[model samples]
Target: MATSTQSPLAQHWGYYLNGVEQAFNWPKTFILFYSSSTVQKSLFKSLFLNGVVFFGGLLILETFYNGPEHRILGCSYANITGFPMYIALLGINGKFFTPIAEKAFEKQAKAHPRTTPGSTNIVQSMASMIYTTIFYINCGIFAAVLRSLIPHAGPFLSFFMNCAIMAYYAFEYKWLYMGWTLEHRLTYLEEHWAYFLGFGTPITALTFFLTTLHSGAIFGILYPFYVIMATMATPKPATPYGQPLTSGKGTPTDLSAPNKVPIFFGVRKMNDLVISLAKMMGGVQVDSIVAEKQKMMKMD
Candidate 1:
């Protein structure tokens, strides 16, 4: 909120600003908005959305069979494709990081918006694109790392979970976020209970599939970090660091909302199956079935 260069993180996040785009000249910048229905309505447009066809084209060619040893963090693509649930969601999945983009845009606006309507409008539009690109790159690098780790996973679990994560996030963005922010504001803070139930649908489905598909390494292997990412995305509004203007920690602000939208909307969240899967692995299924079996045996 304050533009007077307060701390290190503020300094760090400044490179991604709009009026400063020429100063940042990232190979390309992506401008995005909340509406998925529209395409490139703002001054800045992210190429990430356009990559849907490229990934689809690759699916047609089936290039996964004979490509260079994807040294992606040391795992092979085969290992990643092993799980039926880990397919990367081309570029369309960038929705999860919109908060970060907004933060950067606001920061730039605070810093460089001139005292004229034309100048302010141009700065805001351009800043949005630059910030969007930075957020996508951040999500993508982590996602790529996630993809590399699952190279040894099965195709079914690998791609399905990936799709499920992306799909759930889509709901988080389009539904949950709208329900909470816009819908609640319109309804004046009284939200529907269905909103809460729907919050974790994709997550619930994902947990069910993971338990059925990848029994062994489900929880112990990959659930810790996934949980952390989910928490961060649904940050409390008091969240301080919008986007670091500098690198080191700056002042912590109550920037996030307590009921912020879950980040499954972002391309980053892998899934929310950890706790449920953990419970299932603890043998709850056997306990429930034991009662059913007892009833049948009594009849016999």
Candidate 2:
């Protein structure tokens, strides 16, 4: 009957604080976080490959298709500008570092028997990937449309909006890796929007401003750092508002319960799948499931 008593700041802000600490203690945090040589090797290789691809692809495009004007990075200034790259930027993070993070997470899980199981199976990971890709693509399009609607405002508002979106995208891998459902993820984002925005603001500035100054290489390197930090933060769950996640085997101790609404009329979950199908077949009485649920609740 006891409840979590930790303050909201302590619950959700631990990793964020650790990140700030790590910024000050770069060498120590790097050594501690990447103690394993295998992980270090994998991350280095991924970063190298991604950098080559990103820079090489740009070189090819600039040389062959758009000429010098299309070059964004390693140039004096940007002559080509568009919003499509924003969506591609999200995909790049997932394409390169997600596997490495997953590997590290699996290793962590195996080494610590007490660790609660995360949702890292291929099916779940794939589903999360699909869902996130669709979500970000929609967000990118929405940002582009919004920018068009208010061109007089310049990229100021668009940058802020995109930064918030990208911030969620940054932590999303960790959230899904930790087995958070869509409802839980959305709720956490809503409740801690400011914290998340602050967490992601640096990366947003890098992607938007630094890249404009031909500093994509810097952005490329810093990208993996954020992903690594996010991976480290994944297991430590946070409450919706207050209290850090408990050190046990289950979801975070948020005050809100999972939604109980039926996806369709009279269907709450898999238990009612068959009954709902039966009603669609017209072989069972309609509203029977609801009535039965009401009776069960009354009995309880």
Candidate 3:
């Protein structure tokens, strides 16, 4: 936590700096990632398949086949092959990543032993995981649209949005294991927005200038390290300092404190809209099927 003597601005920026420092604390990341056999295996598979095989193949094609016709072929190859390959890697790597995250969380739990409040039902847990995954993907898409649509400040806004999203992704595995709801995670992130922004900066900066496929490949390679860092990190929220009484009237106020930024507010709204539409469509399909069954019963 930030000291009371520091102004709110200083505390906020202090947390941001702390987050940045934590992100690049690679000695700890290396120790964690290499110490566990499971993490090692996952890193190997992710590095080989996503990094060496997929991205390496593209790099080879681009290098060897640089003609206009070859460019067209490369584009077609990426669309037809690389896209599906990436999706498959995500699914495969998800299985590997989950165990890595669980082990990391369990290791931390042994030392900290804090009670995490969340639903224990397997079905509900699965549903929440699925919902959260969709919400994240939706948030990414919305951020991209914002980047393309708005002018002047669009890129900067999108950049910060991506930073927040990346931070969320890094911490998500830990949060999920702790049984935190999506709402709780988002709220915590917003309240300590600066820290996460800084934490997410390194990853975002590394990938930001690259081409889409290149960025995706780099992100896949680096994400596990960030996940480990997030597990080890202790996020400090910005502290509010008391303001002197104005006009010597009433009580001292905390108006000087930095306000919580609702970073995920837009994404939450978007996710809700999408979920509502999906449910409505599903209900319609069910009703249609029931009506068809009723007609068959009448005929019988």
TM-score, per-candidate, Cα-based = 0.22, 0.53, 0.82
Cα RMSD for predicted model 3: 8.0
lDDT of 2 by residue, 1-300 (tens): 134554344444554444344323345327534676655765676566446655555555545767455355743222342223433554465555666566556655665555554577534334334333444455656556556677778477566566556556556666666766554655565455445545665667667654432345446556656655554443233333433335555534544432221111111233244445646776333455445433322311
Q: Candidate 3: lDDT over CA atoms?
A: 0.73
Please provide, for model 3 over 1-300, each residue's C-alpha lDDT reduced to its tens digit, 9 standing for 90 to 100.
222444567667878899999999889777767778888887788778778988887787667765566645446555456677777777677766666676667667766778352422223333444555667688888788778999988889899899999999899878766766567778888888999999999999998777777788788888877888888789975444442223434423333445589888888677667666766778534444334323322311
Quick one: ranking by TM-score, best first? 3, 2, 1
* Deviation of model 2 at 126, angstroms: 7.2
Worst 10 residues of 2 by lDDT: 258-267
Ranked by TM-score, the better of candidates 2 and 3 is 3
- Give me candidate 1's TM-score against the actual structure: 0.22
Overall lDDT per candidate, in order of appearance: 0.32, 0.50, 0.73
Model 3 lDDT, residue 6, Cα: 41
Residue 149 in candidate 1, Cα distance off native in Å: 8.0
